[model samples]
Target: MITSPIWLPATLFAGAVQAWRTALQKRVSQNLSVNAAGLVRYLYGLPFAFLMLGLYQWAFAPSAFPALGRLFPLFCAAGGLAQIIATNLLLMAFNHRNFVVGTAYSKTEAVQGAILSFLLLGETLSALSWVGILCGVAGVMILSTGGKRMEPADFVRALGKPSALCGIASGLFFALTAIGIRRATQEVATPDHIRAALIVLCCTITMQTVMQGVWLFWREREQVSRIFLTWRSSGQVGFLASLGSACWFTGFATAPVALVRIVGQVEVIFTLAFSHFYLREKMRGSEVSGLLLIAMGVILALAGTMR
Candidate 1:
């Protein structure tokens, strides 16, 4: 059992799992509408989420279930809805730009999350952690660009495009989602971060499933049928998404949202590794440098946490 803070390791594990989930979702996206693809994560994952909650309770708190506070619903709704919007916006971005550029723009979530967390939750990071956050962001930018030589002016111009706007908007909503989940977990009257995380995860996933299911039923009933038709792949997405989300929520419960997100930037690195080994893609020098920078940033952040 995690006797101390599990934020750092939890974030790393979540990042790795999320990378695989994203890859699976990308395949799912090919066969489904963006909204339908996004729904798969919640719709298929609902059962697994409940199963996880039951397992947690049986293992850790068999005697009593923690009572949900009044604020729990509000927090869950905010987080669940924000995440759905963010996912849709990200999927829309695929139509506007290439995957690399879209991902780079969306990666601004770390910086935006820091700002939002401070404004909304009054959370502050140490100077070293701030440096880590910046470094991690830089590393992600480098990886996303893949060492392409675009002029500064061209880069600035690209930001004005619709895809960039969608990416930025998605990042903002993602920041809000993280903040809301953290707030929800905090509102739980339990000291067990695992239990709190599980409760919040179950509630959020249930709400998301219902919201997305209703939309699919009315607007895209065919897509709903297609989702079940592709359950084999969709199930993989759901399982990984559910596990990654549980780790992410647990990390949020243990640390400030901004810090948790900064550390979570390691997801880029994991994606790169998958590309290199599975996709057999070669990494460029800039990509290597970016990885090093991300490592340095994560190390600094971990050191800061030790203090």
Candidate 2:
């Protein structure tokens, strides 16, 4: 009986893996359109998602294959499409700024999730949790400014920039995606969290792959060919994405979507480290402060969950 908030570790793992996946997807975006690069995560991950399902069935539950409920497909489709839209918007933002900054904007997903979950799922956050969510949002705002100091007017102006708008829009869609997936997982008829996660994951990935594939086939065949030509990188993106998504779905099933996403904001720290070290990007004092704030927010969120 593991009962010490399993969603905590699951969210942590998802955050780390997602940082890697997002970095890879950013690289993939260099060669493909934002939509095409976003599609690669689904198209390549479809097989690995199925493999994960097979392993779960074979190793974890040999005889229990839970059938999908009537509402599962609707929830899954909504989540899948929302994620695709969010990814495309995020990748498009990547075109305008550094990797960490581009992703930092989308970190607003945590704050957005808090609102959406409350309205849609009747979920409420503790006072400390609200503080944590606000801290996380503050951190993202600081980071998204790319260390540039600005006047109040300039700060307001920055929010109106195209990349900033994309990032904010991505956050909103991602919030919806998280809520939809949580709903889908709850609709499952199984007690096994792993099985439920895998089922939802396989269905969601398949839906995304088909939807993106058909769109690309008609509108961007050359990009489709480029995806295959760059299979090695695309495969890395797919594997990391599948692994991260499995963890995310499991976390979503176990906890409130807002909490899961708030904890997942730790990905910005991971992305910051990746950008500084691997991507050889320089970090500024403001960015460092933002990272520290994010760390504090994550700690506060976890502490709230413990209450």
**Top candidate (TM-score):** 1
Model 2 stretches with alpha carbons more than 4 Å out: 1-4, 93-105, 157-162, 275-282
lDDT of 2 at 10: 88
Name the top lDDT candidate.
Answer: 1
**Every model's TM-score:** 0.94, 0.90
lDDT of 1 by residue, 1-307 (tens): 1234777788899999999899989899899987798889998898899999998799757748888889999999999999999988887776775555676788888889989998988887888888888888878878778688655566567777878888889889999999999999988888888889989999999999999989988999988889989999999999999999999999988888778887898888899998899999998999999999989888887677666
lDDT of 2 by residue, 99-148 (tens): 44556567778888988999998888788988988897888778877777
- The C-alpha local distance difference test score for the whole of candidate 2 amounts to 0.85
Q: Number of backbone collisions per candidate, in order?
A: 0, 0
In model 2, pairs of residues that clash are none
